[model samples]
Target: MIRDLARSVREYKKVSIITPILISMEVVIECIIPFITAALVNEIKAGCGLNTIIKYGVLLILMAFFSLLFGGIAGSTSATAASGFAKNLRKDMFYSIQNYSFENIDKFLTSSLITRMTTDVTNVQNAYMMLIRVAVRAPLMLIFAFVMAFVMGGRMAWILLVVVPILAIGLGIVIYKTFPLFRKVFTKYDALNKSIQENIKGMRVVKSFVREDYEQQKFEAAAEDVCADFTKAERILALNGPLMQFCIYLVMIFVLSFGSYTIITSRGLDFDIGQFSALLTYNFMILSSLMMLSMVFVMITLAGESAKRIVEVLNEKSTLSNPENPVYTVKDGSIDFENVSFKYSEKAEKMALSNINLHIKSGETIGIIGGTGSAKSSLIQLIPRLYDATEGVVKVGGVDVRNYDIETLRNQVAVVLQKNILFSGTIKENLRWGNKDATDEELIEACKLACADEFISQFPKGYDTYIEQGGANLSGGQKQRLCIARALLKKPKILILDDSTSAVDTKTDAKIRKAFREYIPDTTKIIIAQRTASVEDADRIIVMDKGTINGIGTHKQLLAENAIYQEIYYSQNKAGDQDEN
Candidate 1:
């Protein structure tokens, strides 16, 4: 945990060092004021002249002013450092997540990732801020007070020695008991996050089924569990403060009683009553510092757990990394799979795709159709290297796909997935994401090619119209067209539509296909569709069944030669006839 924390801090080397230095200055200022107060009190006890006492009193005020000044500086610096650290960490984590393969991402749920990125990072930031602001002061104050006490009265310092040990034992117990509880709290937090996210995202289903009360009870149960664990941990750790105060009081009694006896018995007045009073002040300062240290321990325990969780993410090695010394470019869009097989997990006996062999030439429009989970999407996903084949080679441009730089290779393939996601932005802004430097004329042309221009122009603001989150304001068909337009704007060598036009009517789909033929030049198009009419005009159609290619041919050839394809075609046509009757 400490090593991970050191690594996290090292990410912002300059700021980390500067924050501690400022905090130290602040603590030194605080420690000096107490000593000046002791001097003023002793001066009055000795019957010092008014001028001397007044001078010491003014010095004490100056120390306090400096303390406040340094405290402000330290706080500002600490906050700045913590904020920057969190921002950079989050940025790095997001970048890493983007690089993760689909298989890797599947290991974590969306809600868990969200919680880690948000709540977990905030926890680490808070811990870092506390370390910078309070951690340095507590230890410095304790040491300074101890030194002052020794100088004021040697024998009186023994009380501190006894009291400090007892406080340490109590702190150790609190830490030992509470550290494990914090881990449990974080686990429960992930569960709570998952429950809330699922309920909110599926709110429509919840309302349709009238499960609101059930969901409320479920949420209440989770909250109650978390509350119970939190109370248990807090109850155990909360004992520290009262126990510390008790210890402090006991030490104070010992100091005062012993010091008074010494002052009276030692007639030589070697250690005067004035110094005895100063010792008491120093003892209180030390006790307060100890209390602050105990709180730091609790924070460190929680932060330690959080740090471990964060490190797990940062240290994860992506299983889909490109080969070292990878080839820099792909020459053409030709894709080939030789004996390609894949599975979601190694433990699974069955493969998602087995012994798949196919070759797609550059500029050819090929279609894939199959039953659900027939590996249609999985096959096309290989072209863009979303996941590597488990057993065989996937090649692009006559070279193994793994040979090309992952980013460079993916840039050449634009895929519109079955599930279309759009950011909150104007239509023009969303299109620009495909190609940041694309001109306005190019954007409009791409929109026209995707059959999106007509609907976009009908909007009140046209291309400048704002889109709600997830394109919620748009109809499903409209969203699909915009997604298609976004893909076209990329001008990629390979364009893949994985059931991308399912929401559009058959006529609109045909129009979009025709526009693609007119505008896109020499682009290898792979269309995965459920509608038979959508892919009937393709140069080749591959029908998949149970994770294997059942037949590969043109639409007419498949209708005559393949039983499964024939069945699917006849069934759909028969359904159309029945509807007409």
Candidate 2:
């Protein structure tokens, strides 16, 4: 995990290396100051002159200033390196997500990904800052202070070494006990984020159903789970503070009692007052270094879980990739599905789309009608290689979609999905997603074909009108028409509308179809709809049932031969008659 995460520190490596070097220099200066003070104390005791005391005092101040300077510089460099590393990490994760296929995306929750990018990345960044600074300072300070303590007060230094193992064992136990709890806590964080995201996204539905109290209770439950787990982990980590303090006090008591007795009895021959003072300073330094180390370990324990989550995203390879040598051009809009079968995952009990054989000529107008879960969308998704077939070949423009570059195939086959999305941007900007370089005239023309220009021209800003996120400001019919206009800007060879016109009135739907039939006669149009009237004028209609095609024929032909089609068409006509009456 360390090796994987370190790769994000590409340009910051120099700063990362410099931070530790500065920390080491600071530790060295800090250790030397106590030794100099010890010598000065001895000199003053031996009837030293005022000039000698002044010289030692000046040297001590210089050493202290340099220590602070190195420490401050180390702080700046570590912050630069850690923040840069985090920026790079978030960039890499986002770019990776953009390349993932639908199947790969389905493996992770949207909320989980958001948490990994934001909160989890922050946790790792803070831990990295600690690792480069405190982590480096602690060990160096402990080693230098230990050596100096022995030199200043021999035999009493053994007392420091004896306490080290006891503290080490205690810290080890604390970390081990808390690590699993922290891991569980992070998982709960993902759940909490998911709950908040769901509530916000479905706020309208919650309010419509008068379920505000229920949603509040649900959010509180998720939040409580996260807080409970974190509290449990912190409770275990709290032992670390008391353990370190106990060892520090024990060491201090032993040093003072023994050293005072030695000084009084031996009459300054052994462990004198000057040496005793310096020894106490070194003792505090060593014990404080251990305290810093314990804090570092606690941070590492928390960040360990976060780091694993981040690395999981970084290590995930897109389940789909371009071929070594890929076809970049599409010949035409002729699509063929040959003995194709697909299941969302290898472990799925049933196929979403079972062995299907179908073909459509260029410029053909095809309509598909299916019940819920009939795999109508699944069958079309394979044409653009959004998800590859598990068993057989799906060909677009007479070449297997897998053989074509993914971008090339998807561009040629424009899909206006069932759920239309409009980002927060001007109308022109949203339309330009289909063709970034589309001229104003082209935008008007596409909107006209989609029957969206009439409403757009009525708006005060026209094409420049600002759309709220998800097009929430517009009615459902308006959003659908705008999305269609956006897809029409692509001028794709094949256009598939996956129940996209469900919100529009039947008269408007007919007008849009008529415009497509008149203006884009050479583009293959596939429409999936619940209303039979939407597909009755098509060249061919497909009836899908239970993940398989039940019948393939023109509207009148299907109505006579296919039971499912007859049931759907007659029921719709009966409802229409009753409405008119």
Candidate 3:
């Protein structure tokens, strides 16, 4: 736990050091103010006049003022540090997650990752701030109070000597029992997050089926589990305060009796009862400090566990990182998969793609048609090194993809995923993501090529029209066209449309493909689609089934020679067969 905390501190080195130092100074003043109060009491008891008493009391007031001022400064600085640390930590986690291989991300659920990034990071941040203020302050006060107690009264200091052990033992028991409980709480938190996220994302399906009640019950069950786990942990921790108070009260009783006897027996001595009273005050201060420290320890233990989980993400090495010596240039956009094989997991024998050998030359339009789960997307994903093959090699432009710098490799490949995503921005702004330096002419040309300019021009603001999150403001076909425009704007050497036009009508799809032929004649294109017409016009068509390429040929050749391709082609275009012919 300590090692993990040290690692977090190292992540934000300057702020971590400054926050703790400020907190330490603030706590030192807090500890000294009570000693000054004890001194004031002693002065008043030593036959001091009202003027002298007022002078000491005034000093105590000033000390307290400084203490409050320093404490406030420390708290504000600590908060700033914690907020900044959390922001940076979250950014690092996001970047690390992005770098993870597709295989690695599949190990954890999307909702679980979201929970870790948001709620789990917040937990660590809150605990970090608490540590800066309360965690550091409590221990310093405990030490200062203990030293002051011994200085004020030697034998009476035994009061703290006894209370300390009792407090430690009780705290140890509570922590030992609750440590496992906290781990369970985090797990329950992940499940609760998953349930809520799934419900929201799938709300349309639930409402369509009229299963709102069932979904609500599912969510309620997850929530109940989380609540029960938290309550159990709290119930155990709740015993600490009462146990501490009871033990401290017993020590107080012993102190009162001993001090009274000493005062009664010390006849005519300078050992005043008020001084003994002051000593008792310091003893209580020590006990109170110990109690606060114990609570801090409990929080640290819980945060320590959370911090470990967070660091696991921050420290993870991406299996798909760029090579040390990478190919930075490509003479032609040719892709080759030589005896390539891949599996989502090592334990799973069923490869997502296996023994795949193919070569796609520059400026060729290749279509990929496959049954579901035939690794259609996975095959193209290798071109940009999204995942490395478990066996054999994948080469791009006559150079191994792994040997190419990730940035250079990816720069040449633009992929439109089946699920279209658009950022919250104007239509023009989203399109510019593909080519930041694209001129207005280039933007219009790409939009036209994507067959999106007509609908975009009809909007109130034309190209400047605002798009809601995920392009919710547009229809499915509009979103698909905008996504295609974004990919086209990049002017990549290799453009891949993974069922990108699935939402559009056959006529619009044909128009977009026609534009591609005239506008991007020099670009290599890979089209993955379930509809045979979408790929029927390609220069080459590859049919895939169960991780293997069943056939490779042009549309006419596939119709004559490939049974799977012929079946899919005939089924999709039975009504339009005469026109297609």
Candidate 4:
């Protein structure tokens, strides 16, 4: 965990190293202050001249000023280091997530990743700052002050021997009891974040279903779980303050009562007023350091859980990685799956797709139709290597997908998946993701092919229109057309539309298919749709059923022979055949 986290500290390492050095200098100056005061007291006791006392007082002020100077520098440096560390941490996690296959992404919730990047990283940053500054200062201050106290008061310091041990043991027990509770508290935080994300993203559905009250109740339950766990943990942490104060006062009472008796009985010989005053200063310093140290302990306890969560993300190796020696160019759009069997998880009992053998030649247009569980999307996903085949080779352009550079392979195979996503940007910017250097005319051309140009031109901004996140500003059919335009802009060798045009009317869908046939004829097209009209003109159509191909033939052949295909065809045409006069 330590090594994993340290990787994010890359460029901030110099600042991190400098912070502790400044803190050490600060501690040295701070430890000198009480000694200077002791010297001033002795000067006054000896009836020294005013000049002598002022000189020691000046020295004391200088020590304090230097201590403050170092502290300020350390504060600024540690802040730079911690914030940089957090920035790098987020960058690292995000970069790692970019490489995750669909299967690896299934390992974590979107809410959990959000919590790790924001809340968990922030916690570690604060703790890191505390670790370099306060943790360094507290222990050093405590050790230095204790040595001075023992030097000044001798055997009377033994009182601390008993008192410090008792205080430390009690504090240790409190920390141990609360540590596990803090770990559980962060998991509840994940649940709370999950609720918030789900509610916000599905707000439209909640309001439409008139389940706003139910969502609010669910959110409250999750929030309350977080609150309850935090309350329990904080209540235990609260004991640190009173317990520390109790130990401080008990030690002070003992030190004073014991010091006064020794001074009076020794007849101004053993423990003088000057030494006694310095011992009192050192005593406060020691107890205060302990108090600050306890606070550091509390912060560490909280951050430990957050650190572990962060490390978990940073340590996750992307399940999909490019081969060391990889093919950089695709020869053609041809795709072949040989005896492919795949399951989302290694522990799964059944495969999502099994024994899939198919060959799609370049420039061929293939259509796929299936029921909900027939693995239509799963079969197409293998073409782009979105998920690798578990048992057999999946080849694109006559080369195994595993042998191609992942980015090179994916770039050639564009898939507008079942879920269409448009980022918050101008429509042109969203389309530019397909080809960053695409001219305005190229973008318009792609949209024209996707049947999106007419609707976009109707908007005030045309191609430059700002799209809200998820393209929430547009209607469902509009969003699908825009997404299709984005994919079309890629001009990929293989384009897989997994029910991407489901929102459009059949006529518009037919036009989009017509454009694909005319504009990018050499591109292998695999269209997955529920409607038979969407696939009727394809070179061939494949019927998928229960993770296997049930039939492969023209639409007319399937309508004549295949029972499942005939049933689906009749089911749709039966409705169309109805007339109202």
Q: How many steric clashes does model 2 contain?
A: 0
Q: Which ranking of candidates, highest lDDT first?
A: 2, 4, 1, 3
Model 3 regions more than 4 Å off = 1-15, 18-36, 264-271, 575-581
lDDT of 3 by residue, 266-371 (tens): 7426455655765677777677777777777778777777777777777767778777887888667788999999876789878889899999999999999988
Query: Clash number for every model?
Result: 0, 0, 0, 0
- 269: Cα error in model 3, Å: 4.5
> What lDDT tens digits, residue by residue, belong to model 1 across residues 389-498?
88899998898988889988888899999998899989999999898898989889999998899998898899999999888899989999999999988788889999
Q: Which stretch of 10 consecutive residues in model 4 shows the poorest summed lDDT? A: 572-581
* Model 3 poorest ten-residue lDDT run: 1-10
User: TM per model?
Assistant: 0.92, 0.97, 0.93, 0.97
Whole-model Cα lDDT of every candidate shown, in order: 0.84, 0.91, 0.83, 0.89
Tens-place lDDT digits, model 4, residues 44-120: 98899988978888888888888899999999999999999999999999998887888888999988999999999
The TM-score obtained by model 2 is 0.97
Candidate 1 versus the native: TM-score?
0.92
User: How many steric clashes does model 3 contain?
Assistant: 0
Off by over 4 Å in 1: 1-12, 25-36, 258-268, 346-349, 575-581
Model 4 misplaced regions, further than 4 Å: 265-268, 575-581
lDDT of 4 at 306: 95
lDDT of 2 by residue, 184-263 (tens): 88777888899899988888899999999998898899999988877887887788788888988998899889889887
